[model samples]
Target chain A: MKNTIETSDRPVTITIPEPEYPLHTLSVLVNNKPGVLARIAQVFSRRGYNIESLVVSPAAEMDFSRMTIGARGEESGLDQIKAQCNKLIDVISCYDHTDDAVVSKELALVKISVGASSRGEALQIAEHFGCKTLDLAPESLVFMVTGDSGKLDAMVGMMQKFGIVELVRTGKVVMTRGNGLT
Target chain B: MNAEPRDGAQTLLKCLEAGGIEVMFGYSGGAALPIFDALETAGTKIKFVLARHEQGATHMADGYARATGKPACVLVTSGPGAGNTITGIMTAHMDSVPMVIISGQQVTWMLGKDAFQEADIFGITMPIVKHSYLVKDAADIPRVTKEAIYLATSGRPGPVLIDMPKNISQGPCDAPLDAEIDLPGYNPEKAYEIDSKDVEAVAAALAKSERPLILAGHGAMLAHAGPELKELAETARIPVCNTLLGKGIFDETHELALGMLGMHGTAYANKAVCEADLIFNIGSRFDDRIIGQPDKFGKNATIIHVDIDPSEMGKMIQPDLKIVGDAKVVLAELNKHIKALPTESWLATLDGYKKRFPLSYKIQGGLKMQHVLDVWDRLTESNSIVATDVGQHQMWSAQFNKSKAPWNWISSGGAGTMGFGFPAAIGAQLGRPDDVVIAVVGDGGFQMTLCELATAVLQKLPLKILVLNNHFLGMVRQWQELFFDNRTSGVDLEGNPDFVKLAEAYGAKGFQIKRPADIEKVLTRALEYTDGPCLINCEVVKEDNVFPMIPAGAALEDMITEKPKHRMEKPTGST
Candidate 1:
């Protein structure tokens, strides 16, 4: 349904700039309880902010879990969201990858329909992207790839010409690269 | 002095009463059996209505909230039970109705392992609900429950979820009943602080502009500022245009009132909005639907947007003056700053346009939806509440019926959910038992949740339902006929059940109006019998279309004023 409210005729476009540096991830420790995720989400939702990717799992210790959240917002909006998360009782700690040393990886599986003419080209593209063939059906090939979300997105975009039949992505899952597991 | 050991379930019942929740709608399932068991043993004051389906439970809660303006609660089991409530949650969210949805999850230890009937209820509902939480510790139940209710009813109201694990419900905890939840940044009444200079600039623009228009939104209804808005518009003698969600805020029959605006808006209303010199927007988010192609919208006018949320000020289309403040307070202050101006010439210009494109329907030979709205106008008091489902019927109700009071027209505006009318009417009826409550639904929309008729019948609530039986998804078919080469796909209802029989099955009186002559008599009979719920199914022409339509992607000035020659080829009976 539409609103018939009058408005100004002049076109106004506000272009939000991309981050100055490469995108980063955050590892957040929160209470593994009901509503904790919601509380964390409320911090973003109430501000009309959007999270690019989020993955939640149990932490090394019981009664606690970790969520790897990826987002791109203006500096102040991001700061406000992080501060809001810190105030929730269930949240133990939050670390921005830009400020702290962390490791992030994303996994994706792509099924491509390849005819005889495109089979070799599709395989070549997969090898170029370091993707392994998971399944080789008579008419299709499934490739499994793991990397940062951006790299995976690029790989998917490159393979679109081969006629992607299906795509499944396990969103960005991150940890502290090595030796440090919180 | 040792009291009987209380389980988490009993404690939950105690907390519910303490939190002032009088009732809940839910069904019993394996995961939620513990709570039901506790209810049986504890003999709590809270009443639980057993719903046939989880969706029904959520709809009941939605109705209760709409009626009472309080957060009504619903309970469901883990996994599929919880998943079934998503559509209703989305409906409530889209309509901005307040509700607290509680779903039982698997035991805490088995949460991530894909246990029986286990699903990520919180994650699944994240986008739909206002806020969703999973309660891990039994001790935090009281605080979470209180906070959920508080959050659901506060701000731009919507659904909130509380997913409790089975173990938490059966666990032991010692927490005070008044465990305060100090949510550091939680402030429900936070209004955006608008700059004084912006307000002054808008006031100056309004003072100077000869053809200033006032546009109201759902925010105006939320703030209960309808009276203040009407006063400001009438005092300033400015024309008022309303969003679909903002309908009924101003008397549609008023001289200054321009009918609902947007894609399906009347020609005169859309023309006025598009051509105004200065537009004062109050408590509305300028959604894309209202301002089609923002770049070309309101090019001739200056927009002054006033909203409580600061981000909404320039989120979509930029405004000339952006003021972030409570709509009521802002309108009252704007009223104080400006004196009544003579808009006789502007009114005359609009009146001429209104006369050129007056809203009317042919009274040829059979029952028509417009005729039903006309009867509704005569039968219902000014304060009567009218709820509508999403379809061509909803548009008809908005266009043909006259609403004099704010909130009297309840509908799923943003979401456009089909099954909202029946339950919302029940809620509105329950909210104000002294006033008449009517549900205006289409044949397709009425069937979406016709089971709610049992809720009204069992509760002995008097809700009059007027179903426009076009035997097709009227709106979709209209679009298909107009834009899609008339290739009707999944729009026709070939084998639908008899609605009168369906009403009879629910123990409600049913009236069928098949001819133009039967409209007044059938409506009078339905209005006369006020003992229980009733349904009036008016079998309108199956191919009838809503006219004066602005085709999709078309500007307001380019509306289809007359029905196409092909559509008029068949002389379908009308009223």
Candidate 2:
């Protein structure tokens, strides 16, 4: 409903700019039940918040599950989403780890296409990056790497120089530092 | 000997009985045959109201909930029946009315196979409902039933859903009579600890402020805080203005009442709001329509917002001091320590505004919607339950009719659903059988759910339906004429059916009034007819528009008053 008035009677108003959005990781503790993960996904999709990366696993207790989700949205919009999620019965709690000091890890499996000459250098680089060798074929060397998201990115960047043939990375999983609960 | 296994339908009834749902509005279907069969044989004390359409059933349930401060249950079949109630569900959700909606689903094994009459109702209504569940087992019936009622009626009440698969309902289970729902995260009574310091701060603000006004909203009504609100307002000597949904919370006939404030609000109320020094917004979200320009809104005042929803605190208009608590509790606590203020000149100034800029409309040729409402209010003694459809008529009803009781004025405040008035009036009539229930609708909106006319006719409800027939979608036409360079779009309702004949065809009495001379007499006669539902086709001036409008983004003070073409003498004995 536009309120613009003509005939030199009303003053024109300025329209505000769109809000700023940033990527955030939230660790949500929820009841471990059927379709609980789907419910959380539905909540995010309903609010138009796309999940960049997600990892779900059983929490410290067997009856509950913890999900680490990376998403991007305006601060106010995210705040509203959090409030709405907080209202759900199965959701025990949700915490944003982006602003907190938390330990996080991701796993990546890479198969590097290696010539007989480059095999030695690839193994050296993998060892330097703390990667474990899963298999060694005639033309390719498979390595398993586990670290934080940034470390995985750097490891993949190093492997890109050796003509990486294939790669797959699990999304980040996180735990709060100290005695804080997520 | 072992006890015989009770079917799912019987268990469903037992759970509903446990929830204390005395009445339900629904239309049976193939998926819900088991439920109907159980009701037929069991002879449960619960009364079932057979509505013509599922949408009508939902609205009726919404009306029942709003009028009685209790959650009303609704039942519908799968797919279309469930989908039809979305508008009504959204309407109730937006307005914060408590309701429990039960829809039948396909057999449990056939859920994802896209079997006959399956539409994934639980998934479809996810965003709209307060909470929803797809009942997987019959053993969870009692627990789900209790949780549904609890979630729907507690803390900032809203609608909840339970999608029951036919197999679950027809299967056998022996659930406990009192099922304990273990919900660690679902605490409905999330009370806010109101600080004594904050109350003192508010009292201090009010004590020194020269032009303080109280903006009471629907939350006050929901909280049953009318008495406390009146006590607070009178104790502080602050003038009160209601939001559209907040109607009847403060007695409209009271001296301090400034009617309603917002778009198409009374000129005086908007003026008072614009000029006030301390604006206390109780239980209002300060929606866009209310605050024309957020930056400029309440510019002269320190806005103090008291509401239960913390999300609503700083959402729109930022409050200098926010009290997060129920309306009644907060008002009661404030009243304990508040001292009366001396604002004689402020009240006098508001009175002056009210007298100078009274809600006015000049009559042209045919009858006016405002006049019809004025007459209806007068004849009904301003005490009837009034439900209004959206558009020019809704605004006119809100402006002209003075609601004398709480929850008496029910309308689609946030969603503005068109066909809401008729079924809502029927629900209100059933809720308050002794009171006169009237549905004020425009011709454009009246035709939306007029099929419910059969429900009213067959049930023999004593409802008064007033159709303000203007032969056009008057509100959109007015906007087109003013804002869209006077180029009217698809707003003309040329081949509209004869509403009087339509009502008669549905076995209800119908009256037609086309002139000013017949307006009052015909309306009084229609109101006096108490046999069954009556429809009054009021062919009013086709171009009449609601005035005192705060143009979309303009400040409250920039209200545009009507410039009628010709002025006629004021009618004698008019309200």
Predicted model with the maximum TM-score = 2
lDDT of 2 by residue, B216-321 (tens): 8988888889999999888888999999989999998899999999988998899989999999999988977788888899987999999887667777887998
DockQ winner:
2
lDDT per residue, candidate 1, B320-401, as tens digits?
Answer: 8877678877777777677677678888888998999888888885667887787778766445688888899998888877
Task: Determine which window of 10 residues in candidate 1 chain B has minimal summed lDDT.
Answer: B566-575
Q: Across residues A6-90, which tens digit of lDDT does each residue of candidate 1 receive?
A: 2122222223344553454677887676668777777777876667678899888787888988776566566556655654546
Candidate 2 C-alpha error for residue B424, in Å: 0.7
- TM, every model: 0.77, 0.92
DockQ, prediction 1: 0.05
Tell me the spans in candidate 2 whose CA falls farther than 4 Å from its real position.
A1-21, A33-48, B1-4, B563-575
Residue B515 in model 2: lDDT: 86
